[model samples]
Target: MTAKPTANTRTIGSHFTRAGKYAVLSFQAALTIFPIIWVLSNSFRTTDQILTSIRLVPEQFALDNYLNVWRMTSIPRALVNSLTIDIVSILLLLAVVLPLSFVIARFRFRAATVIYLFFSLAVLVPMVTVLPMTFKLFSELGLLGHKYAIAFIYVAEQLPLSVFLMVMFMRTIPSELDEAAIMDGCSILDLFRHVIIPLSRNGIVTIVILSFVAIWNDYLTALVVLSRQADKTLSVVLGYARNEYAVDYGMMSAAIIFAIAPMILIYILVKNRLIKGMAMGAVKG
Candidate 1:
């Protein structure tokens, strides 16, 4: 009883749908890229030009921003401090969280739900609320302004989320693997090393990437704990940039670009594994 669409009509409908999607996608892409493009363009412009001009491109490209940021600021030290905190915190998170998560996921215990609830509640408590007390404790311990001390705090703050992620991932891994390993005379440590850790590489990598990014970008905790200028992380250093010098837009842009470069490179390298890990966890859980 219904008339079929003519070829021309069908072609027009298809074209419109395609055009609509492309238009939406193009806008989203532009929104995402615009800031980065603006920063890069401004990084090559002089301070006067940046203040006076709204143009996206500089009339004359200059490398002085990069040179000035490197020479004037403690950017190199900040970068190193950020990296050290990120690496140490992540390693500590892995060392502590992995085994505990494995046990919690694999075993049934009377206090399991209670323990899980405790950790879940910890995540709800914001760092800002706890920082005052924590800073006092760190001061009492004489650990304030130390990179390792900051790393420890990062690990503690990050643990709940890391444990939750690892537990969920470990649960998805079959108990049969553990039983088989045991039958072959594998100890708990051996089983974890050989069977569990190997299979959970994707999840581990995802955790590593996420944790690193969080720690690297963290400003509040670092500012609170690292009062020493020499020990300040990249995020903290960037915050103090204006006070440290006359806010050179070009140099500021250059520092911002440098700060984000490592995270961008990491995302590019591990994006596939990260996607796969999330998919696997979501599907299995």
Candidate 2:
């Protein structure tokens, strides 16, 4: 007969398993971070240096590439445009989805299931599939080449998934809280404002970050929608940064660093909140 493993043997086996997992994760982290570090190093070096060797350390560090990108390129204006669109779109989406998601999660309406299913189906539809129709509508309405038009389009594009996500998160919040609030003579609006909003802060933050990142990195949608140079987003500006003859590796690296800096900063600032939120969500869910 086979012998059962002792507790000490089980503990040793678990240690090895955890150590293996950590080793794998550490290696993956290195792979992910190396490219970013290489780009940053190259952004400080001259074009000739980049062509010669893929080095982690720059021979001659200079800020000229960054200066050129800022002074000569459309990066600055494009950043402003991207920021405006992302922020405005996220606000509009939250405004519409928050209350809608609450109703869908809490209330039992005749068409609630249908509404939820419609949104779930919408998430599977490709944005490209509806582009031609959208373009035609925008052109007819004279909304083409406008920044706010793009922002509104972004909100519409993201709304379905946003609603679904918020609904799921709201479901995780115990209904007992809602019942208690109702018993205290709280109106629906009061319950939503005072109870649900506070509890769902982490989920809302995650949504905002996801939405901002999506809209910020968007290239195809912005390329199709905005015709004017002044209205172009950062992704469009980065595309235009490429040289026709040969890729300016140094300049391109600098532009990329500039483009990703905001996202990196945002993640860094809110990383703790993101982790806590996800953990809470998993437990509550």
Candidate 3:
């Protein structure tokens, strides 16, 4: 037999649990922020100063490292390459995945289960496992140095997960909405464009943000596919910069900042929308 706890004991246990939760959150916040602060501080100091200094704050601040990183590296071209790939790939994913996911979620076709199973299996296949075959296929297709090829690959790579997520989110929408649209004499295309697309806005936004971040940070695929210095993505170019700069922490830090800033800024701007979308999807799902 189990006994019910007294008010005093319950209150004490709740207090201790709250304290533990707060302690964990504080520790996590510090772990995430400290490295970023340290890097930002070191970016203002010289390579030698960074090596010798033990303090987080720099005695002197200068922009020379940033200037050198911009002028000396192919980062500018890499930025252009990354943006092009990310934008085009995301657009392509939306074009294909949205409609298919809607169909899978709303319809009762015999092949729907089979199709969903196919994409689900794709999610389980590790991307790295096919790098050799991917490289050879792209090379043979004469797309090794083209930005569009990378964009194509990104769309294909991201499609499975994005479609799966959309399907899951779409299922949580009320079926009555579909019935009402159809009763109003809406055609299949009209129903999709007007009812389904608008209703799935939150899920769509979630996929866009996730895909953007994933493509922006991808390095291995870009490196293997884009061999030319002028065509490499930001991550690939950063690797080259690291090799060239070697132990120069100041320039390295600046390069890291440059590579990461665009994505961070994008996230900051859309974070509110992202959080709302995720929360709504979670509750609906």
Candidate 4:
């Protein structure tokens, strides 16, 4: 027979459990944020100081690193290019993936499973595996070094996972909703636009944020396809900085900070929606 704890003992146990969880959570958070803090701190340090110092905090603060990175590097232009690519790719993803997912989820077809399997397989194929062939294709099409080229590739790469996620979430939405819309004299397009899209907003947001993050951070595809400095995105531009400003630790740090800033801002703004969307999609799937 086991003895029951008194109220005081139970309260103490509960407090201990909560404290342990908080401690674990805080540790994890620190692990995640530490590098970012270090990078930011080092960005303000002189090159010699950064090279010499073990601690992240600089003895003397300097803003010239940021100024040098901004003025000398193609960071500003690269940022614009990244933004364009991300926005265009996201829009195209919405156009193509959402409808495709709806069809796969709502309708039963003979080739549905096979098609989905093929797409799932495509997702497993790394961009590196196809980069050479993709480069040849882009060259032949005269799309190499073009912003839209990157946008197109990003959309293609993102479609499989986006569709997969959307399909799972779409399944959670009752077929009754589609039937109701149809009974109200809604066409297929209308059903998708007014009913399905509205209902799947959370899932869409999740896809958008995920895709943006991926495309924004991508360097491999940009390196392979974009030949000109002017055409390069932030990732590629940052790569150049690694070589060109190798001795300038402060400048390099500043560039890294700039590269990560957009992603940080986006995560902060859409964190709640992102979590909700992921949870809903996971539960439905």
Question: Which candidate gets the maximum TM-score versus the true structure?
Answer: 1
lDDT of 2 by residue, 1-285 (tens): 234567778899999999999999999999999999999999999888888899988887899889888887788899999998888888888998899899999988899999887766756678888888888888999999677788777887777767767887899999999989999999999999999999988679878876777788898888888878899999988787775213678878888999999989987998886565446444532
**Candidate 2 regions with alpha-carbon error over 4 angstroms:** 1-30, 179-185, 244-247, 272-285
Candidate 2 positional error at 254, Å:
0.6
lDDT of 2: 0.84
lDDT tens per residue, model 3, 108-222 = 8999999988876756667788878988999899988676778777887887778878998799899999899999999989989998999899789889987898899999888
RMSD of each: 3.1, 4.5, 4.2, 3.7
lDDT value for candidate 4? 0.84
CA shift of 211, model 4, Å: 0.6
lDDT of 1: 0.84
lDDT of 4 by residue, 137-218 (tens): 9999998857677777888887777888889878999999988989999999999998998999878878888788889989
TM-score computed on alpha carbons, candidate 2: 0.82
**Residue 72 lDDT (model 4):** 83
Prediction 1 TM-score vs. true? 0.87
Identify the runs in model 1 with alpha carbons over 4 angstroms from their true place.
1-18, 272-285
